[model samples]
Target chain A: MAKPLILVSNDDGITAPGIRTLVEVAKKIGEVVVVAPDGPQSGMGHAITIGNTLRLDRSIAFDDLDIVAYECSGTPADCVKLAKHHVLKDRKPDLVVSGINHGSNSSISVLYSGTMSAAIEAAIEGLPSIGFSLCDYGHEADFSHTREFVEQIIRQALQHRIPENTSLNVNIPKKSSEPIKGIKICRQAHAKWQEEFDERLDPRNRKYYWMTGNFVNFDKGEDTDEWALVNNYVSIVPCQYDMTAHHAIAMLNEGWEF
Target chain B: MAKPLILVSNDDGITAPGIRTLVEVAKKIGEVVVVAPDGPQSGMGHAITIGNTLRLDRSIAFDDLDIVAYECSGTPADCVKLAKHHVLKDRKPDLVVSGINHGSNSSISVLYSGTMSAAIEAAIEGLPSIGFSLCDYGHEADFSHTREFVEQIIRQALQHRIPENTSLNVNIPKKSSEPIKGIKICRQAHAKWQEEFDERLDPRNRKYYWMTGNFVNFDKGEDTDEWALVNNYVSIVPCQYDMTAHHAIAMLNEGWEF
Candidate 1:
């Protein structure tokens, strides 16, 4: 049988250590094709470059490795779109993998994550997809410890594909010396960021403001990603793109007159 | 009664004719406070500015019109966050109105729309919100016939707040001489873009690609937002932010191995 075609991409630039690490893990799964943002699209969410144009070029990042890779000059969503409709137009990928991102996309942050957006775009295209993000946000954050967990999840997902209506959001906790705790199946916790802007001026006497925010985790339950990360365990939350709150649908129907 | 405080924003930059019209209409309904992007953020989805700082400056766009406006250095989602948490820190807005957008965000496009993102952000913040867009993408697109529709919907939404867990995604047909048909409340039609990357060689002899895609509507039901917009009527699709596909949860519970 032909090797399962794995379409890989990320919010970080193609050459970013995160995607480079992702490429390494994906190669073991199947024939890996890397098409990711040419630059970081960290908080890009589901943004597409409609008002502007996108550029794509094959990357040398995978030259030494045995994988095909391309870098796209657009948002994370655009990378998936370009990959499916242009680069891999004639052939459908068996599975799509996004990220191994430098930062976490757990809970409310999921709504603004480019890493998750790439996975959502692929899911919309009917490809089984997953987005992986580590708790660390530093550019040089350590992703070495995440290999075993990443491989286990990827191998399991490839073996038993996730349901059609769902996409996986896997967030690994920062490392500890002890053996990493096993994965926990969880739901997205109700959480949000409390933001504040710091006003400042440039040397040219021009005013500029820097956005700063505090991540306030209001959900105290042990089931949340926040708790799992704090407790030094990997969290696996199945997510979806359909924003329709069907449970609220019936309640909304009764409240408003159409 | 004292005037209602209406917060206005758009994905199109502040100078766009669409937003000017929106400001004009909103002023009649209440005190308008405009917090919009300094540049166009068309497909920004629900993105927020986390890594970078956001800047906001008071604007003189509608100085004589009595609309207090600010040009923001962030995505639509950031604009709403700034407005709610900073700009109007004291008084809660009676209505949060986003976009007299230059283009439609009818179907799956809603998930990638900066216009709708602002509205949904307000919805998540427990405020009444509505996003309005024209089917035309042209800069010079006429909105003369849309005044009454905009006023009607805004009035209805304000008088009777939208259903809980719901915000309105309203799309108006382009300028027409014929009498306008009434509004239809509907669901987002399932749709996606088929991307094409236009590769080119720059002056430096480097290959570049421009992303382009034709909008594809696969939904056939007459009860969809796509159908309503196509039939020359205003479409009001109640959008929500909760992305959990709850129906799948039941099935997952029945079939999954922990």
Candidate 2:
């Protein structure tokens, strides 16, 4: 049988340590093709390059490892679209893996995450996909500790089909002194960013604002991603791109008159 | 009793005619404040400006009408965040309304929609929000016919609470000789874009690609937004920011092992 083709991408640029690590793991699973953003695009969400043109350039990120890679001049979602429709146009990959991101996309953050956006784009294309992230945000955050679990999760996803029209959001807790706990299947927690803008003066002494925010979790349910992270467990959330609030349809049908 | 306060925004920039029509209609309901992008920000999903400095300037778009408005140098989601945190600092608005967009945001288009992203941002912040779009992509498309339905939906939303953590994705069909049928409360259809990148040579003779796609609907269900739009009825889909596929949790727990 031919090896399963795996398309790997990330928001942290093609050469980031995170994707390098993700590539290392993905190679063990199948034939790996890396196509990712040329620069960091952390909070890009599901943005696409519509008004602007896109550039897809060959990169030597995995030259030593003898893998095919490309650096795309667009957002994460753009990267996936370009890969599927241009670079890998004739052949669809068996699976798509995004990230091993520097920071978490555990709950409400998922809505603003470029990492998860890539996975969601693949899911929208009817491909099985997974986005992996670390809870650490530092530039040189330790990723070695996540290797075992990351491999395990990817293996399972490739072996068993993810639920139809769904992608997996896997967030690993930062390396800790205690041995890592097992994985937990969880839901996205009810949480949000309490936004704050730091009002400041630029070099010209003109007013400009820098966005900052605090993450506040309102859901106390144990089956949530937040709970799993706090308990040092790897959290896997099956995410779907269908934004429809199915439960609310009945409410609107009954109460709203037009 | 005080009239409900409505925070209005759009992805087509502050001066666009679509928003003017929206502001004209929104004012009939309550006190209005507008904060939107200074330039077009189409396809900018749930992105927030983090690494970049943001500029917010007072705009005279609604000056004659006596409504407070500001133009922000950011994405649509950034407009909502800036409004909630900086512009409208002390007082929270009763509701958030985005668009009256120049283009459609039905079915799978919602994922890449800056218009819907603003409403989803408001939903994440626990506000009752609605994103209104006309199924016409032209800049001068007639939105006059949509006003009555828009007013009715907003009135219903303000009178009765939206389901918790949910926003409304409302799309009105373009003007026709036949009047629009009543609004239909619908779900996001199972659909996706069949992407095609129009590769071309730049002035520098470098190969560049323009991203384009055709919308393909796999779902033929009558209860979907696509069906409602084709029938000339306004489609109202309740959208949620939580990406969790709750039904798949049990399946993941049983099928995949750590």
Candidate 3:
């Protein structure tokens, strides 16, 4: 049988250590193709390049590993679109995977995650996808401990396939002394970033603000992604792109005069 | 009783006619304040600026009406953050509204909508928020017909309150011969943009691509937002920030081997 074609991408750019680790693992299981941003695109949410021109350049970043790759001058979501519709137009990828991101995208952070945006973009295109992230935020975050679990999750995803019209948001705990307990199927925790702007003056003496925030978790349920990561386990939250609050429809219909 | 403080914003910059219409309606109901992007930020979904500085300047755009307004160098979500954290720190807004956007943001377009992002950002901050959009995509779209409906929706939202943790995504039909029948509480229709990249060459002879697409609606459901808009009714879909597919969680737990 032909190897399953896997398309790999990330928001940390094509040269990030995280994508390299993902590529290393994916190549062992299937045919891998990489299409990612040329530079870091953290906090780029589901942004797409509109009213702007995009450049897609072939890259030699994966030459040593003998893998095909391209660096795109666009957001993570844009890279996925270019990949599916242009680069891989003739052949459909068996699976699309994004990230092994250098940080967490567990709860409300998902709303601002470029890593998951790539995965969600693929999900919107009717492809089975997963976005992986480590809870570590350091520039040189350790991805060694995550390799085995990453492979396991990918294999399981290929075998069972993700639930229809959904993508998996898999967040692994950072390297720790204790072994990971197991994987937990969890819901997104009710959480948010309490933003605090750091007011500063530039050389021109004009005021500018730096966005800083504190993640505040309000959900205490053990079934939440936050709880799973806190307990040293891999958390998988199946996510759908449909933003509609179906339960609220009846409420509005009953109460709203219009 | 004191007047309700209504916070207004948009992705079409501080000076767009769409926002002017919104301000005209909102000020009639309550005290109004505006914080929006300095330039067009359409299609910038949930994005926020990081690794960069933001500029927030007081604007005289609403000076004639004596309304407080500011323009920020950031995305729609960032505008809302600045409004909540810095601009309006001492006082909490009774309501938050974003856009009478120049274009449509129905169905899957919501995933790429900057207009909805501001409203969703406010929802995450625990505020009653609504994003209004006119179906017309013209530079000078006719918002005349939408005035009454926009006002009605805002009044109803202020009176009845939106569902907890949800923001309203309301799309008004473009002005036509026949009047709008009524408003419908609807769900987002299953749809997607089939991207067609228009390859071009820059002045330097470098290949560039323009992202353009045709909106395709696959859902034939009468209860969907697309159906309502097509049938000349204002469509309102309550949108939530949570992307988790709860039903798929149990399925993944039972079917996949962790």
TM-score of predicted model 3? 0.99
TM-score of every candidate's chain A = 0.96, 0.98, 0.99
Q: Give DockQ for candidates 1 onward, in order.
A: 0.51, 0.90, 0.91
Output the lDDT of residue B12, model 1: 90
Chain A, candidate 2, TM-score of 0.98
Better of 1 and 3 by DockQ: 3
lDDT by candidate, in order shown: 0.83, 0.92, 0.95
Over A1-258, each residue of candidate 2 has an lDDT whose tens digit, in order, gives 888899999998997899999999889879999999999998999998889999998999999889999999999999999989899999999999999899999999998999999999999988899999999999979999988987898888878889989999999999989887899999999988898999999899878999998999999999999999999999999999988999999998888666
Any residue pairs clashing in model 2, and if so which? none
Per-residue lDDT value at A20 in model 2: 92
Candidate 3 — which residues are off by over 4 angstroms?
none
CAPRI-style grade of the A/B interface in model 3: high
How far off is model 1, as Cα RMSD? Answer: 2.3
Q: Write the per-residue lDDT of candidate 3 for residues B1-258, one digit (tens) a residue.
A: 888999999999999999999999999999999999999999898899988999999999999999999999999999999999999999999999999999999999888999999999999999999999999989868899888998999999989999999999999998889999999999999999999899999999999999999999999999999999999999999999999999998899889986
Give the better candidate number (1 or 2) by TM-score: 2
lDDT order of candidates, top first: 3, 2, 1
Q: State the displacement of the C-alpha of residue B165, model 3, in Å, after optimal TM-score superposition.
A: 0.2
